[model samples]
Target: MGANLILVANDEVASDPLQQKLMKATAESSGAEIRFFSLEKTIQIIGRAADRQKIFIVVKTPKDVKVLVDGGVPIDEINVGNMHFAPGKKELTKKVYVDQSDKDDLHYLKTKGINVYIQDVPGDHKTEINF
Candidate 1:
């Protein structure tokens, strides 16, 4: 595949050695070429090359997707992975939890014509984040 793996995060996340290591490990395990970018930089770079590059964006939260979209990044699809379910948050799936904020952000993304899928693994059947 000619796709590139782009991990999007803020400065705090990009500065963490453990986070960087984990992302690198995951990328290597998946045989993807990985690059890190802050939210703003992600918008800038993806805005420039989204049409030409098969870029997979890994974001920390749904809010990040909203930020990118609000900033004019052309996001046609998004995958919400690693959503750790905890008590009190409504369990959407074994690996996904949602509160009001998550629901709101997801709704916003859907209304903007972005397809959002939530799963630790692709193709797992469950409730979809459809509008």
Candidate 2:
């Protein structure tokens, strides 16, 4: 997306002090303006940034995309990478994991006209995701 701003929207960092520290460290090392914000504030930030920046939002779940689109962010596509394994979740690829909620969220996004795909990294083969 040629994004100039990297917004990390994972709420898990709020509770995990180590994760927050690591995130900050990553930003410092990469020299990227990585902002930690909730999805609600993310919308306002994006609106304010639209005219002056390109944003790449990093989120943990498909629900995050749904929330952004529902709240009026123009997200037309999503590329999923590695995901943590959770109880009751099935592994789709070595890196992709999903539970029923994830499935439903992805289906919802698909119905809303978003192109969903799984590719762990750029230049890797992308598998088109279908509900």
Predicted model with the maximum TM-score: 2
User: Which 10-residue span in candidate 2 carries the lowest summed lDDT?
Assistant: 9-18
> Tens digits of per-residue lDDT for model 2 on 1-131?
46666788766754577876787787675556767777787776676775677777788888888898898988878998777798998988888999998999989998989889998877888899986
Return the TM-score for each candidate structure. Answer: 0.82, 0.86
* Tens digits of per-residue lDDT for model 1, 37-120: 788887777656755567777677888889989988778887776777766678776677877888899999999887788655
Once fitted onto the true fold, the runs of candidate 2 whose alpha carbons sit more than 4 angstroms away are: 12-18, 29-31, 50-52
Q: Backbone collision count in every prediction?
A: 0, 0
- Per-residue lDDT value at 110 in model 2: 88
Top-lDDT candidate index: 2
Candidate 1: the clashing residue pairs are: none
User: Candidate 2: what lDDT?
Assistant: 0.80
User: Which residue segments of model 1 deviate by more than 4 Å?
Assistant: 50-52
